[model samples]
Target: MSMNTLKRTAQIFLLACCCLTMLVVARSGHKPAPTVDDAAKVTVSNVKFEPRTLTVKAGTTVTWENKEGSHTVTSDTGAFESETLSAGQSFSHKFDKAGRYPYYCTFHGSKGGHDMAGVIVVTK
Candidate 1:
């Protein structure tokens, strides 16, 4: 190849390698931590859990913000429980174990797996 062609080819090859390296680094690097608004979240509205079911990775902390009525986040297996929360109140629980955690609102819900109840599924 001509000298100019060889130089252009080398430049293009270096550019391609840099692009590929960036892609690999992006794919393998640590992801950004979940922000407050982006974390596993639930809202208590209309006397029910906004998301009746939630799935999250192990060690994630889920927050429940009570927007309307009085409520409580009581665990079925007694893993973690929150005190009664009034309107505009919030609660948070961290899941360290990988399993299903069923919870309910003591003041306005049941533990029979429905009627204001919620479940959190944690995965490894």
Candidate 2:
């Protein structure tokens, strides 16, 4: 084969390989998680979470702001939980799977006997 023909073929092969690599690398792009502004939010007011239950897509983060007093976000199923939040404080959880996670306030429950309870419904 001529030198020019061989060089052209090699260039085409290199371009194809580069395209394949680029496609593979681009596939790693993941959709960003939804935040409180985009996903869902729960407010702890008067010793209760306003809108006690909510549904959101997987990978969404839900933020709960304490409006009354110190509170603890304890997962009922024990998969995950958060630390105690003081008044005007906040807690957040990111749901990664499709299921219902029932949770309550550990601190409040001891004193008020189950004053808080909620569920996170995750969808695809």
Candidate 3:
């Protein structure tokens, strides 16, 4: 081959090698974290929990935001609870075990007699 043709061939070969190396490196790289929006979410109008029940890994932090006014995050047994949170207020809970945990709001449960509840299902 002519000197120019040989040099051009070598350059093209180097470019192809570089492109293949980049593809291999990209394929071996770590991926971005999965955006699991299931665990932490907000409640909507009428004191309802959005995705009221969720399944998550143990030790994952779950947050509940009361977008609907005058809501509470009370234990299913009416034990542990949060006071009425107006619009834009929030609450959080963590599940240390694998089971179904249910909760409700006291304010709506007794007066309007409407129960605003949620469940957290934790697993391995």
Candidate maximizing TM-score? 1
What C-alpha lDDT, on a 0 to 100 scale, does residue 74 get in candidate 3?
Answer: 72
Ranking by lDDT: 1, 2, 3
All candidates' TM-scores?
A: 0.69, 0.63, 0.66
| Candidate 1: tens digits of C-alpha lDDT, residues 27-110 | 999899976333689999898887999999888899999998789999988998999899999999988889999999988778
* Model 3 TM-score relative to the real fold: 0.66
Candidate 3 C-alpha RMSD relative to the actual structure:
4.4
- Minimal lDDT window, size 10, model 2: 107-116
Model 3 CA deviation exceeding 4 Å by range: 2-30, 33-39, 109-115
Task: Kindly list the per-residue Cα lDDT of model 2 for residues 50-90, writing each as its tens digit.
Answer: 77788888989889888888887777878777787888888
Clashing pairs in 3: none
**lDDT: the better of candidates 1 and 2:** 1
Please list the C-alpha lDDT of all candidates, in the order they appear: 0.89, 0.79, 0.72
Model 2 residue pairs with clashes: none
In model 1, the runs with Cα more than 4 Å from the true position are: 1-38
Q: What is the model-wide C-alpha lDDT for candidate 3?
A: 0.72
After superposition of all CA atoms, the RMSD between model 2 and the true structure is 9.3
- Single out the weakest 10-residue window by summed lDDT for candidate 3: 107-116
